[model samples]
Target: MGSATSSRSRASWLALLSAFTAGVGLGFLAHEYREVIVANPGIIGLTLLVVFAAGYLIRLAVRALRRAGSRVDTILAEELEKKPSPRPR
Candidate 1:
């Protein structure tokens, strides 16, 4: 379980790094193509819609993970409470 958690953590960091790199690349692309992008109002609107939708989905996923983590912690605490403690010598 510890290893699994570590792996997940590593994956998350990698994902975050990848996202940052992608954002930087996209920024450069936009900078280079500013005129083209500006010329297409429809493209701007579509990109905005997609960005908002992705943001909304990411928000929902984060909320769900937090709720799940809290529920797991509560269950683990309850289970621990139910277990008898070792007797003192």
Candidate 2:
């Protein structure tokens, strides 16, 4: 249990680190290629929009899956309750 919790936190920490690295890399690119980025503002906007949309879609899919899993768990529990216990021979 402790390891599971620690791993979950570690995953979140890694995500944060990755996001930070990406932000720094993008900032560096924007600084270095300011002319190119400024010239194609539409491309950058579209890329950001796509990234946000994909993240939202993934979040929705995960939520739906979790709901379905819980429903299956409940259904299985109810079915189990309806069954009789076996007698010892």
Candidate 3:
């Protein structure tokens, strides 16, 4: 149980770190492209909008996958619980 908890905590931390890293990378990329973005304000604005929308979609996908995994886990646990335990000799 303790190991499971620790592993979960580690996974949570790793996820957080990955999110932060991705955000930072995106920010850096945006900064690097600021000049080009500024030159074509209309296109830049559209691109930014697309990026935001893509991020939202990605977030939704991640959430859906997590929900699906959790549901599967719950169903498996329920099925396992319905099984009788083996008697000790």
TM-score of each: 0.64, 0.71, 0.63
Q: Which pairs, if any, clash in model 3?
A: none
Alpha-carbon RMSD, candidate 3: 3.4
TM-score of 2: 0.71
lDDT of 2 by residue, 1-89 (tens): 89979998998999899999999998998899999998999999999999999989998998999799999999999999998878765
Q: Whole-model Cα lDDT per candidate? A: 0.95, 0.94, 0.92
For candidate 2, which ten residues in a row score worst on lDDT? 80-89
* Candidate 3 lowest-lDDT run of ten: 36-45
Model 1 TM-score, all chains together: 0.64
- lDDT, candidate 1, equals 0.95
The reply for model 3, stretches above 4 Å from the true place, is 1-35
Report the C-alpha lDDT of model 1 over 1-89, residue by residue, as the tens digit.
99989998998999999999989999999999999998998989998899989989998999999899999999999999998889865
Best of the candidates, TM-score: 2
